[model samples]
Target: MGNRGGILPAVGALALLAACSAPAPAPVAQTTTPASASAKPPTTGPSSDAPALGPGPGSQPPTTPQPPPPNSPAEVTSACPFLGVTESSATMGVVLDAYAVEEAKTTQQDATTYHCTYASRTGGRQLLDLFVTVVPGTGQIPSLVTAWTKDCKGPAKPIGGVAGTTRTCSLDGADSGDVMVLVVKKSHGQTRLAELYVRPFTDEVYAKLAQLLTDRL
Candidate 1:
């Protein structure tokens, strides 16, 4: 799975209906010419014949803000319980294996910042989710977590994997809380994961993810 770039948000849908009817046509002028010539014709109706109606009583009330649509497959795949594949391609650059329950949906988030999360059922006893967030230029990035409930049981430990040239440390930590950031020292800033939380920074994964960053960044 190549590291795909962000896509533009979709446009909103609009449904417009032409007014079912128009205001009654203005009353036509009736001419009553007296038999005795010399009666001057009446002036045009009320200067400007247009209607004198005031604004509609409650025309176009302000629309309430709408909630964003549920996260999409792209979003869920990115935020996974086990594996994530970039929308760009499915070449298996990253392989996520769920160590527990069958594929299912789970919600996760960070308390410190605004982040978008998407989770999916990757197979039996394993789930994977992705999170994409924008950090303030001067703000700090929150630590990532792998959380689950007490009743929910499985192998929630993090794993190490290789994605392209970059190395990642994929962990199964808390159920749905914060997790630490994984950094690689070799690249020295040439490659940094953007809007993502990952694990397993072995040499092979490092090379693969580095290449992905080069292409994606």
Candidate 2:
């Protein structure tokens, strides 16, 4: 009976050890939320409904619009200022009454010019063109004289007792019949150019007319 009792205790101890060593039911196979589902989604770019930005304070201001320039070389009244019809008729020995004038302005150079034309009253046989140019600065008169007398082939003959430098030239051509050009420069940088077309070109008459015009200038 003692040996059976010992055998029963040993069987009970084996059952207790087996129960302790069993693999703890495999931890129940846990289910949890994924990391991607738990975290916030990443942004793509700026929102389409956002407000637009304007120019900044440090940026340059808009430029102001400029005004346009005036029309150049426009015609004006046809009255002669320095010379008149009576004086031109007496000088050229013809009857002159008709007169016409045109004006031109150079804003860049700050200069103004007036072109006066005188014709005979009888048959328009005799004609004279006088151009008066005024520039504000000095050294501008020579260029005007050069431009006016560029077509004349005669040598420049200086005259005496004039306000400024005076020169006369007679052009040489059948098309340019009896053409005499006279250029006079005044003290205040003003220039007067005269182109005469008469039947007979007389130096004495041209000198007298030049004197009268320069005296008036």
Candidate 3:
């Protein structure tokens, strides 16, 4: 349902509009966001109780800090190249033959972004898309994702490995239908935005990937 990094999204990018209705709706054509997509600084919350942190360093980022000039293809997202299942290590039972990986050249202007999509060879269904947006700050992402939990279906609970929280969203018939998971955690001086678009994943597997990614960062 989301773009796979750069300007263009690979196959099945649009087939993900609506998720989990009794009978899935006809897949609607959707356009991916351009590479220049910018993230809006999260809106101010109830007298914001969080403090921003200084940018130091975390796990080595995937790509070079300075990206190529605009309009060029972005580098492969750095942190989790281990994503995209194969014949040996499949994700959730789907043996994805291949995956589409791309990086956001200018995500949110100041943040770095990476996206990966794993799916069948013949196309149609995009089993999963792992999106990571690394913005420089501390507590902002955790605060933002936590704030979002208030309207979500599940309770926001803490998980080990990463310093963050996880929550599943409730449907308001306003989403793309994918049962997604939102995990926000902190590393040295950056906040991680790890968003997964998958067919309902258990908290265990979700935490595994979250830890793996956080460790990579």
- List CA RMSD, all candidates: 28.1, 49.9, 14.5
Per-residue error for 216 in candidate 1, Å, reads 3.2
- Cα shift from native, residue 108, model 2 (Å): 7.0
Query: Between the candidate structures 2 and 3, which one is better when assessed by lDDT?
Result: 3
lDDT of 1 by residue, 21-86 (tens): 122122223324211111111111111122222223533322222222322222222222222244
Candidate 2 is scored at a TM of 0.50
lDDT of 2 by residue, 66-105 (tens): 2112211232222145556566668767654444332221
Top lDDT prediction, candidate number: 3
lDDT of 1: 0.22
Off by over 4 Å in 1: 1-122, 125-128, 138-202, 213-217
Off by over 4 Å in 3: 3-82, 87-91, 147-163, 170-176
Stretches > 4 Å off in candidate 2: 1-79, 100-108, 120-123, 160-163, 173-178, 188-200
TM-score winner among the candidates? 3
C-alpha lDDT (0 to 100) for residue 190 of candidate 3:
62
Pairs in steric clash, model 2: none
Candidate 3 per-residue lDDT, tens place, 1-217, comes to 4322321112111001111111111222322432221233221111112221111243222231222222212323442353435421333554544334342232433554455434333434444555565555574553455433433335544554444455444222233344545565565576655555554445565566555444444
**Model 2, CA-based lDDT:** 0.35
